[model samples]
Target: MPANIVAQARGIVKSFGGEKPALGGVDLAVTPGKVTGLVGPDGAGKTTLIRILAGLMTPDAGEVSILGGSPAQRLDSIGYMPQRFGLYEDLTVRQNLLLYAELRGLPRDAQEAVFKRLLDFTDLARFQSRPAGKLSGGMKQKLGLACALVSTPPLLLLDEPGVGVDPISRRELWAMVAELTKEGIGVLWSTAYLDEAELCDSVYLLSEGELLFSGPPADLTGAIADRVISVTGFADRRRLALTKALDRDDVIDGTLQGRAIRLLIGEGHPVPDAAALDLGPDTKVAPTPARFEDGFIEKLGGGPEGTSKLAAAYREIPPSDAPAIEAKGLTRVFGAFTAAKDVSFTVPRGQAFGLLGPNGAGKSTTFKMLCGLLTPTSGTGSVAGFDLRRSAAQARSSLGYMAQKFSLYGDLSVGQNLDFFAGAYDLSGGDAREAIERVTQIFELEQHYKRNAGTLPLGFKQRLALACAVMHQPSVLFLDEPTSGVDPVMRREFWTHINGLVRRGVTVLVTTHFMDEAEYCDQVTLIYRSRQIASGPPDALKAQAGALTGAADPTMEDAFIALIDASDANRDEEAEAA
Candidate 1:
């Protein structure tokens, strides 16, 4: 039923360097003036399909047509944005835009008009002169989007554009997308997030390089609408409840939302009653509608039915009795720009603390200082009782840091990367080898042991990065956008490991754009424009924002947006008073 098909593939099959063909007899279509989603988990051939559509790769046996001809011949008619934005770090925002515009051969007048429109919509006008390398992650994503939109091609291909972006930014980006679609520009969006697929006009579900299903998200979700059940309790109890619920044969998957747990019941298994399962003296359960994610999980074998055990044998607890991480008036400056201004916070031992903010807000700068990667301009901080300035090595020795970018030698095999990180953390000989083996099993990287780190899928890369960072088992863990680009099911499993470690006394300092992930943290801090604008428990933050916005029991996303709005209002008031 698609019209004006801008991109289409039939019986597509592709293989890579003598390996199994990533794509096998796949068929796809994208129409003008509509948003089409290519939804799949890691290693599902979504990337392979995108490559063929963009003429970056050839199909072993199939035909791909773009704008009625071969994809390679339609480069000027389509705009593409890969997962990695491919921006020149040294180039200024304006410079990058101009370069992309020139590459597309847009006239000078058309380029100026389009650039102005893009900067305005992306909210990057003020940062035009700033170097692309210096923009925050979220801002950088917007700039990438702007660059892709420069020529406004008839068709657009966006690959996971919202992977690590915050919900607010994601919404903003989608708003721009909606406008573009109305203008009759076709969009092919690839994503691992099932929830995002629901926004598309049509969705093609891929699994293991084959089409699992293709249709509207509503119809897909409706197929399993009768399976979901809602369970409620306080945060601590909710987590315990979910962990315990997994024991039931009927439970497929469960995700925690503040104090509530949404569980998917399996058709083949029998569900136990609440009273029989010890759901406290006061508890209730009711059937709820299924989400696209619930259906996706059901299709994928219900995911590790029994509990996935998470236990850490190594511990690096310091003898001194200071908080796990302490930053008092921490400040860091680059040239004339203050990346972190008067930031102070304390993460107690065994607590999971989340650092959140818009791009370019200094969260990474603050994280670097605490992890000993960068020195603070002023103030003092310590990790596990080791002063960052006086005992920088000691401080870092007690902590593990996973950077936003998967920082590992791409050419090196997974085993080599893990071994290297283990050595870097001072683990060598049999101990390092054993540690590598343990993490390989725990992180589910056994099959990819001999594969090059870069050659593995995005999800596998994330697993490798986490494995390398945690190989030494530091008492304090610093995770930056750790779950970015991971599918929902894997994301749940990843959090299970984090929570399990927290139970065993590992303190976590994490930065993430996923508000749901923030609920897992014991505390949340929102940093804006290089300052800590707000900090508290998730519920408390929501309650305060709810009080002002009249939103009853607001979700974390709602609360987060309200807090930013309030901060902006305060600035306006101060300026008016002056």
Candidate 2:
């Protein structure tokens, strides 16, 4: 290992009695004052490699070095944060700090200074007395990061620390990590978000236990620069154009960006012509800058194309002029704290609707009310033309829901789980067998049908969850952060299936932290501080924020952050006036 390298791994390999090794002859390095990103899809051996490097697990074969010592020998000099950070929920912020400080072997005399610095750095000084469980998602993440830095370790390992964090909080977390790197701390960040990978000083792209690429993010993106382009003038048919383009042999990948279809074509192909793609003649194609995700998907053999078999099996509901979903003055209160206040929205049949918000912003509370998982403290909601308060069971029966976390039975086999969910949905005998057979074949789960759901890869688990949700083929679907930790390619696959369902007259109400995914919605309501801040179509909202930001093209993320900032400023001004 070089003197500048803080940690190094050579020929690392590990397997868990599977046909493929978890990590096969992988090599990686971390240097001082730099962020080295581990970028890959779920089940890409990232967690396994990180565990081996953290000394928590031993590799079958490998040479490792950490700060001039073995990973196991230098445990005290490394800060490691796993995907599910261990924060004591009952403990107050200060108490959590004290406990971590003690665990890190910090002397009592030195604790106060360290604790104060962490609290100030993480912006948690005012919340020191509050229990960890009472904090928002972003605050909890910051506290976890603070705990890992208690001893000021030389190297830090973060495994998907920004999974469910909103754009604003994600940027805040990145800012903190960036500050640490400036102080000569080496960091290894594992993430499924390719945009984060693009910001790293260097990146190790892994897939299926192999190192696909390793270097500056720009280098990978540069490979596809000439082949990338954005097609405009598709108008309202942009989604249809994107689906059509991706199905072509020349087009390697395509996604809707605002009103344009961003595409990645195969090498040696000329720039796509509008007529060639069956788009109207007014459509214009212009070469666009390639992004890290563009390259990532291209390398993964492109995203899924064509309509979903699962969606094709769906049965359309009867036509109705009434909104498919309606929430009128819905409010929920826990004690004196209002989780959702007078929230309202309407979704037409076959339309994709989005509910977006920051952490602890009442979106989830509103979602739960619509899902029939929680009764609103006041107000009313309806699903599929059925009143929620009066016909909760009928409304629930008309919808399919995929929770934020995997909600299927982990102990059961994939086939068993399918059987169970089918039965629960009232499908029995011929109906149960048909639905099971349909999902298994459509989702490509036959290979793992007998395997336990718990042992399946993250991507496979997600597939199983979605399959179970759609077993009954309900008229409405509720997806809560459906692709929270999934890679770009897998996310695209899921959305493609969703789009197919929408075209078949199935209403979709989804909530996601990924702003890019929000662009797919026909209508969106942005909630903050338990109230609606903005409600409109995606392009209209983007245009509204663009007017304030003075940008020609503002992305969904830009609009989201701008709206929140504006909302905060207004609240601050009101407080000052009072």
RMSD of each: 2.7, 1.3
Best by lDDT: 2
Mind giving the per-residue lDDT tens digits that candidate 1 earns over 448-513?
899999888778898888888788888899999898888776787778777767766789999988
Error of 1 at 245 (Å): 1.7
The deviation in Å at residue 59 for candidate 1 is 1.6
In candidate 1, list every pair of residues with a backbone clash: 15-21, 136-360
Q: In candidate 1, how many Å is residue 228 off?
A: 2.0
lDDT of each: 0.83, 0.91
* Candidate 1: residue 300 lDDT (0-100): 79
Task: Give me the displacement of residue 394 in model 2, in angstroms.
Answer: 0.7
Give lDDT tens digits, candidate 2, residues 34-58: 9999999888999999998899999
